[model samples]
Target: MEFNPGPPLLQSAPRRSFLKFTGLGLAGVALASAGCHIQKETPSGRLDIGEHDLAVLNYAYALEQLEGAFYEKVVAGFYGGASALEKDLLTDIRNDEIAHREWFSDVLVLKKVPRLQFDFSSINFTDRKSVLTTARTFEDLGVSAYNGAGQLLALSPFLNHAGKIVSVEARHAATIRNLLNFGSFADSDVIDANGLDGARTPAQVMALADKYFVTKISVADLPTH
Candidate 1:
């Protein structure tokens, strides 16, 4: 059955109303003007993500942006064999990603990096296997990115906010995992022997995620610890 993905979300629309609607105003207050640093393209023509907390914020923003775009495309034209449950779940996930993306944008304000362009040409969205695989990858990457970046944040508020967002991302990851393989939500691939989810540094995540982006992101200035 073809799922009506409903009206498309306007990614470019102003975020103030959305913030109010989601009761995220307080969170926005905490993040207001969080990143005031002016970022420039490196000599190699890559966008430098700055240093310290701002760098981590920009990195999360970039990933959220990517996830938002990916989900939009998925809901626009769902893959074959998508069930009613799948459609509903995917739609909810899409909305979640949009909120995550815009929250970072609204809070960062001037400090938010320029929106990066993406290239989803590699995935065949019409194929269920391909779409689910890619979705799983994106969700998994988002969780790991947050887990790894949390330590880099110096501000307690920033860390606290990241914690909240990361928990949502983990839920998305679990849901997608079950969609792909009923009981693989906490499989060995993602879970460590110690029973904790694995984490990846900014550089590691960028290395895996850069292939889908047309705009080259430079994580050189991001903290190693």
Candidate 2:
């Protein structure tokens, strides 16, 4: 997929009300209605994440939740001296992540995992560098998560959905990169010598993502191949 350097596609609704309708405000209700009755954590104090397609989708769902929360917090109170472009881009990305999280919930229904909790005490939202750098990290991790999980998806629709979402994620990563250092949208750190984007297995992703989560996640049931 090609990365577009233009401004993010904007949403028409006011930012204040968007989350109320789509984000964490309704997350618990959505999962409940979807019939995701699983306990939040097992006896070992970890989330199982399920198996096969469900596992992959749950993994994606977990990441989306993390990204959605991060962006929501960032947009709610932008960093000091934040540019108008920064606010707009972050707001757009927040909306996108909320949409992605809800979409996965709607699709997974009975198989969806419980809504997980997060702890962002380590991030300084008021600091510009910290916020954007974290945004860059989450976006890049998201792209790699989808890329690495693609091979494990057993169904076509899930695979197609992942493809569509990852392209948008790649754009987010590119946008953040350019914001940090102009012309570094597809920098070598993410894009390799063969012009291929990076990919990370479920275990590798969780290793990085775990620090921000209050909910312990277990990928033991997730397909390795």
Output candidate 2 Cα RMSD: 6.6
Best by TM-score: 1
Per residue, candidate 2 scores C-alpha lDDT tens digits across 160-195 of: 667888999998999899899999999898899999
lDDT of 1 by residue, 11-108 (tens): 34456764454445455554455544445888888888767777788899999999999999999999988999999999999998887787788767
Which model scores highest in lDDT?
Answer: 1
Stretches of candidate 1 exceeding 4 Å from the true structure = 1-39
Model 2 Cα shift for residue 18 (angstroms)? 20
Backbone clashes in model 2 = 0
Candidate 2 Cα errors over 4 Å, as ranges: 1-37, 40-43
- Relative to the true structure, candidate 1 reaches a TM of 0.85
lDDT for predicted candidate 2 compared with the true structure: 0.80
Clashing pairs in 1: none
| All candidates: TM-score | 0.85, 0.83
